[model samples]
Every structure is written in structure tokens, then in C-alpha cells.
Target: MLQVLVSRKIAVAESICSFELCSLNGEPLPPFTAGAHIDVQTPAGATRQYSLCNHPEERHRYMIGVLKDPQSRGGSQAMHEQVEQGQTLTISEPRNLFPLAADGKRHLLFAGGIGITPMLAMAYELSQRGVDFELHYSFRTQASAAFLDVLAEAPLARHVRLHDNAAATQLDAATVLAAPTPGTHLYVCGPSGFMNYLLSTAASQGWPAEQTHREFFAAAPIEHDGDQPFEVELASSGQTFHIPADRSVFEVLDEAGIEIETSCEQGICGACITRVLQGTPDHRDQFMTDKEHAVNDRFTPCCSRAKTPRLVLDL
Candidate 1:
């Protein structure tokens, strides 16, 4: 973890905000991809992850935008209130789990609220490559969005659609997620409820799970029936941990002094990712797709579990 500081803070909107930050040591940082995110250790030491919106070619400083969530548990509130110029902070190196597939012929990007950050970078990448793509940005109002100028500067201004309405303008999941032509990929980032409905609707419309992609800002509730306890074996140490019926995998690992790189313990961030060497993973995290598991036997330990009694994991 590297210590950084709040170099500058500027209010982008009534509730949306942006910050220009740099390493406290004033050294150049590591490079990251388009959809990369950094785990921010807030002034209060509360760890949170936010996507990097800056261009990949620029590496001197990192830029991040935060939306003032009214329901925030003092994290975003503190960012809006106490995080000022020259305040010290600790941040993790960038980590990117949602990257654009090179083979995608047609790209459909969706953004809701602050979810536009990563999508903007994706649009930039696709534009640089002269790829065919479209972006659908949905928000409560135009004032609530950030970086409107950059979106308009893209190659396909006609392909950009903005819908702002708190009551009207329902996310037409069916229409927006219509059958993808061959080599088409759909990527979405938003709140849990919006993503759940959109994904289910897309699935109903015959969009394969592989063609649909999503990035989660928060973890959705786990859909489970009766309680079940299981054993998780750390492949390296050969030590088994008993996951209690009520406790989550994160709580158990932390209590055992296992240093798992994680930001959102709720499973929104893909930081606590590990390989599922054996057993069936009851994947509860939103960061990965079912198709990804078919090729790579990886899983997020923050929310995923084994369907069998004993599961082996690569720690």
C-alpha cells in the first residue's frame, strides 16, 4: 500500500465530484489498463475501490471521480466533506478485471450514474482502434453525469444516447439488449438492481451469458436457500477453514490472518480473487461471467463458495 494525498478536489456537479490526486512520495506510479481500479484507503482507513478514468498513455498522476451517495456509510460523505487538498491517504496499485476482449466486433456499452467512469475509458480504447461501438448513458438528469464533453468527442456521437429521468425512461433491457450479431459483446456497469434486471432481460432475449458483461459498483445479495456450512482448503498451506453457516468467506479468512487483497468485502470489487482448483463454486460475486469460469478456473473468495463439502482453492 502506497501513501498518497488529495492534491485537489473539484465539484463536478451538485452531487458528483472529482479529485486530482498523486502519490505522496511524488514518484511515478505503475501503469494500468483502461478499466483498471484502485483500492482507496480513505482518510478514515475505510477501504473502497474506484475506477481509473484517465487515459492509459498518461501515467504521472491518477484521476478518480466520486459520486456523493446519500446512503453511503460515511465513506463518500467523508470524501465530500473532510477530504481536501493536501490530505494524506493510502492507496493500492491499480487492478483491472473488466477488460475489453479484442475479438469483439460490435461493442455495446451501458453506464448508469458514476458507472460511466470505466465505460468512458473503454470507449476511448475502442475509438483508438477504430472499433464499432455504441454507448447508452442513463441517469436521473444531465447535471448528474461527468465528462459529457469527452463522450461527445468520440467518433460516434450519433450512437451516444442519454436518458435522464427519475420516473420515466425505464431501462429498456429488451430493446437495449436485443440479439447481438456475430462477434458482438455487451458491457454494462451500474447498481445491483439495474444490472440484475438488465442481465435477466438480456438472458430472456437469448443473449448468451458469454456475450453479456458487467461491472459492479456493489455486491448484490446472495440468492440462497437453507444455511450450509462448508470447508475451504487453502491449496498452498494445506490448511482447512470451516465457513460457519452465518459468516462469510471473508470473515473467516481475515480472522485466520490470511492477507487476501480485497477492497469491498461485499464482493463488488474483484480484489479478493482466487483460483478454484477443485469443487463447484457457488459464485456470488458479480465481477466474473460464467464463460470466464469455463476457460479459467478462477473465483472471487469474497462472496463465492463451494457447492461441495470440501473445496480446494489457490491462495
Candidate 2:
């Protein structure tokens, strides 16, 4: 954990605030890639992940944009209400689950609402590297659009396209993802509905799974009508524990004195992904691809359950 001081906080948009966090000491911070995010321990005692929006080359400080979500689980509300400039915050080292493809000839980035945070950093890096890239940012209205002035002043401003629903300027995923281009990669970060539309459209237009990348701010709420009580067995120790329907596998393991590294308990982050030694898993995570879920060799215990009566985990 790194202790940092919030040096500045500015309202960049209607409900979005951009914070600049600097090291407690005047030292260079840890290096981060374009699409990296840091887990912020909020005042509400919730560990929330926020994307780094500033250019990665600037190592002195890290910048993150936080939206005051109406449907927040206290994390966003805490940042918007309780956090202030000069306040100290504990943050984890930057981690990149959504990284730029090293070998892609061209990159296409799609951002929806607050999802533009990570894409902004990627744009800066791509511009600095003189790579071919374009960004399409969609928001509800011009007033709600974050970083408009900043984006306008960027050197790669011409490569950005903005669509506001209030002006009837909507992004047609069918038209944008009409065909798959060779050596071109697509990265999308957005709400679940918007992401589903883009991904389904891309798949229909012949886009390969490997060429498309995504990061979700939160997992879509899944129905638990089919969920049932199950048992989990440890491979190392011949021990088993009953996982009630109301409790997650992670919770059960933790109750039994088993610890696992976890960041996003919503199953968006792959931090708590564990190897499955035996039994099929009822995969419920948004982190892994369909192919990975089909393999059934690993599972995220944070939200996933067992399809069979018991799951043998390689713990």
C-alpha cells in the first residue's frame, strides 16, 4: 500500500471530479502502463478501483476521475462527499488488466460516460508513441462529458470523436463495427448494456475474440434463482466446507481461515481467480472470456459457484 496525498481536486464535468494524488514524500511514484488502475481505499472503508487518466510517462503524480454515481455502493459517494484536497489516501500499486496490445498496428478505443478514464491515458500514450489510434467518447450530454477541454487541448484531439445523446448524435455500433480490420485492435470500457451492444455488434461483424479487449466498471447484476448450496474441497488439505447460497465461496473460505487476494469482489477483477482441480464450475465472472470459462480449469470464487454438488479447488 502507498500513502498519497490528494494534492488537487477539480470538478471536470457535471458530476465528475478529477483528483491528482501525489506521494506523501516528494518522490517519483511507481511506474504504470497506459490502462493501469489503482485500488483506492475510500473513506467508507471500501476498496474501489479507479483508472489512471493521466499520461503514464508523468511519474510524479497519478490522476483519476471519479463520477458521483447515483447507484453507488458508498465508494463514489465517499469520494465525492468526504474526500478533499490535501487529504491522505491509501492506494495500491497500479495494476493493468486492461492493457494495450503490444503488436497492434492500429487501435480503436470506445468509451461510454465515465469509462473514458482509462481510454484517456491510452490516447496520451499512443499519441506520445506516434501510434495510429482513434477514440470515440459517448456521453449523455455536453455538460456531462468529462475532460472535454483537456481533450480539445491534446495534440491528438483531431483523432477523437464525441457523441452526445441530447444532440441526437448517437454512436451506431453497427456502422462503427461494420468490418474487422487486420492488425487493428479494439478496446471498450463502458456500462454493461453499452458494452454488450458493442461486443455483440463486433462479433456479428467478424471481429475475433482475441482482438477485442474490455474492462467493466462493475458486473451486471445476475439473477441467483438457480443458485444452490454447494460444498468446496481443498486439494492440499483434505478439508471441505459448505458454501451456503447466501454466501460466496470467498466468504466461506475466509471464514475458515483461508485468505485470498481480492480487489473487485464483483468478479470484474481476476485477482481472486483460483485453479479448479476437479468438478465443473458455474462461472459467473466478467473477467474471463467465454473460452476460458469453457475450459473449466480455473474459476473466480468471489462470485462464481459450483455447477456440481462439490468443487475441488487447488488451494
Candidate 3:
């Protein structure tokens, strides 16, 4: 973790704030590529993962755009309420799970609301590389959108297409996704429903899964209507631990002196991914692709539960 000072806090849009974090020391901060995110230790002690919105070439500081969620589970609430411009924050190094497809022939980027954060970085990097790409951004209204000016300026303006719900030219995923090139890639970030619809449309249009990538802001709620207790056996010590239906494997293991590094407890960060030696997992995370989830070789312990009565973890 790095101790960084929040240098600037600017209201970029309605209910959204962009935080500029500079290193405490005079030294340059760690380097991060586009589509990277840092785990921020919120004032409420919750670890929230926020994507770096600034250009990857920048090393002096990191910028993250955060939208205030009305139903915040602790992360966004404390950030808006207690965090100040001069406050020091503990943040993890950059980790990129939503990297760009650098080898692709062409790129199609889609952004919805705050999901535009990472797309901004991708556009910057893609523009720097002088690649062929287009960014389509959708928002309820222009006021609710963040970084309109940033998207308007050079290096990003031409490649972007704005689609606000109030306007007639809203995003038409089916039409935009009509053509499918062999090496054309698609990337999207935004609300779960929007992402799903676009991805599904692309899939129906014969877009290969390998050519598509995404990053979710949050995991959809898992229905535990028929949840049951399960058992987990560690491969290291062969010790067994019982996981209650109401609790997660992360909590149960942490209580037994096992520490699993985790962020975005909602299962969207892919932080607490644990290898599964045996047994099936009721995959509940949006982090892993459907293909990865089908393998059943690993699962996020933060929110995923076991399908079998007992699971053998490679812990």
C-alpha cells in the first residue's frame, strides 16, 4: 500500500467527484497502464476499488472518478462524507483486470455513466498508440455525465460519440454491434444491465468471447433463498472449516486465522480469488467471465459459495 495525499477534489458531475492523489514524498508514484484500478482504503475502513481515469503516461499522480451511490455499502459514502482534499489515504498498487486488447485490428469502446472512468484511460492510451477505436458514452443526461470537457478536447473528442437518454440519438447497441470483423474487439463498462445487453448483442452477432472484455462497477445481488451450509478443506494443512449459510468463506477463514487479501467485497474486483482443488462453486462474481466460471477451478471467496457439501481449496 502507498500513502498518498488527496491533492484535489473536483466535482466533475452530478453526484460524482474526481479525486487527484499525489504521492506523499516528492518521488513519482507507481506507473499504471490504462484500465487499471487501485484499492482505496475508505474512511469507513472499507476497501473500494476505483479505476484510474488519467492517462497512463502520467506518473505524478493518479485520478479516479467516483459516483456517489445512494445505496453505498460504506465505500462511496465515507469518501464523499469524510474524505477531504488534504487527507492522506492508503491505496494499493495498480492492478489491471480490464486491460485493452492491444493486438486487435480495431476497438469499440462503450461507457455508461461512471463506467466512463476506465474508458477514458483506454481512449487516451489508444489515441497515444494511434490505433483505430471509437468510444460511445451513454448517460441519463449530460449533467449526470462526468468528464464531458475531457472527452471534448483533443486526443479524445473525435473518437467519442455521446448518447444521453434525454436525446434522440441514444446508444443503439444492436445497430452499432451489427458488423463483426475477425479481429475487431469490443469493450464496455457501466450498469450491469447495459453491459449485459451490449455483450449479449455482440454475442448474438457472432462476436467471439475472446475479442470482448469488460469491467463491472458492482456485482449483481445474489439470491440466497435456498442457501445451505458448506465445508471447506485447506490443501495446505488438510484442516476443515465449516462455512455458515449466512456468512462467506472469506469471513469464516479470516476468523480461523487465515487472511485472504480482498477488495470490493461485492465480488467485482477478483481480489479474493481462491483456487479450487475439488468440488463445484456457486460462482457469484461478475469479475470472472462465464467461460472461467464454467471451469470451476477457482472462485472468489469474498461472495461466492460452494455448490457441493464440501470444497477442497488449494489454500
- Per residue, candidate 1 scores C-alpha lDDT tens digits across 1-315 of 777777888887668778777876778878888788888877655777888887766677777888888888777777888788888777888888788877899999888879888887777777777888888888777778787766777464666777676657656868877765779988888777767777788788888777778889877667767758999899999999999878777789889998887778776667787877888777777776767755447777777776789779887
Q: Rate the local accuracy (lDDT) of all candidates.
A: 0.79, 0.93, 0.93
lDDT of 3 by residue, 269-314 (tens): 8888999999999999988888999999999999999889999999
List ranges where model 1 is wrong by over 4 Å: 24-27, 154-159, 166-171, 223-225, 290-298
Better of 1 and 2 by lDDT: 2
Model 3 segments beyond 4 Å from truth?
Answer: none
Clashing pairs in 2: none
TM-scores vs. true structure, each candidate: 0.87, 0.97, 0.97
Error of 3 at 83 (Å): 2.1
> Which pairs clash in the backbone of model 3?
none
**Clash counts for all predictions:** 0, 0, 0
Error of 1 at 288 (Å): 2.9
Q: Could you tell me the lDDT of residue 109 within candidate 2? A: 97
True-vs-predicted CA distance for residue 268, candidate 3, Å: 1.1
- TM-score, cand. 1 vs. native: 0.87
